[model samples]
Target: MNVYAKNILRFVVIVFLQVLILNRITLHWFPEPAGALFIPAIYPLFILLLPFETPVWVLLLSGFTLGVTIDSFMTTAGMHACATIFMAYLRTNVLNALMPRNLSEYINQQPSIKTMGWMPFLVYSGFLLLIHHLVFFSVESWSAASIGSLLLKIAASFVTSMAFILVYILLFTRQNVARA
Candidate 1:
């Protein structure tokens, strides 16, 4: 399939999985911090998987669309939109900072375990995940009284999201390797 077709498919699939399946999974039983803390949002993986050559405006628009879709389903206006835009905006900087100096030729490729190496890919995904989750949860609980609980919620969500993203990469990234 062509790149545009592939991206469309990926966007649909990730959004469906996120809203229909993964969003329903509760990592914890009680709502100590909040009931929403356990929902693992893997949809950001779509943003992460975008081709590196994708323009900044395109990335931001895609991120905004993706986030708005999630927000529509989850009934949290602008939360996902803001977080996803943050990730998309910072994606290039993270990629440039983590990737090696001589690897500019790979700039147009989609990020995956096979192309970027497991460690670098994880670090890249983890950092973005942390940022997204931090912003997301903070926005969700935008009260000074809940700052400490928000921090904990962000940390927990980050760990769970990283684990999910790592597992996803391990399972799906090999296709890119085989093609390469």
Candidate 2:
């Protein structure tokens, strides 16, 4: 019920969905010869939902731990770790730019459509997800050999991840809509 306990539970649930469920499904938008596909990752939503007051050190540490956990399960070496950490690093800046007030004003609140409204929240999460996907795909291929293919993979994965994250917000974050 408390924030810490809630976050801990969220961490477990997101990772469970990512590792056991989403990881099992792969999306292929391109033909077989191109071999461009995507595996949507909703785990970044954990970091996105963390409280505004969480320290940078804590963010980095959490990102590393979360990424390492996924890496261990999915066995992609350290690709997830690398991408998550990078997303964590840029999270604050993205929030600052999108938010009208200082993050300190939002100490008691987590970023969500209810708190920040849909556009800002989506932009914040979308930008970080983009960073995560870019870093992840880049590290996976470890080369720019197929620039088109890489971009396609990133785009496909980003879109899928965003859709999943939106569904998650709608289902779990809760909304209080009042008709005026």
lDDT of each: 0.84, 0.90
- Give the per-residue lDDT of model 1 (tens digit) for 1-180: 789999999999889988998988878534764534479889999999998778789999999999999999999998999999999999988988987763346755788877788789888999998889988877877787967667777777788777787777677654644555
Q: In candidate 2, which residue ranges exceed 4 Å CA deviation?
A: 177-180
Q: Name the weakest run of 10 consecutive residues (lDDT summed) in model 2.
A: 171-180
Please provide TM-scores, in order, for all candidate models, with all chains considered together. Answer: 0.89, 0.95
Clashes of 2: 0
lDDT of 1: 0.84
lDDT per residue, candidate 2, 89-148, as tens digits?
A: 999899889988888888779998888887888889999999999999999999888988
- Model 2: per-residue Cα lDDT at residue 74: 89
> Which residue pairs come into collision in candidate 1?
none
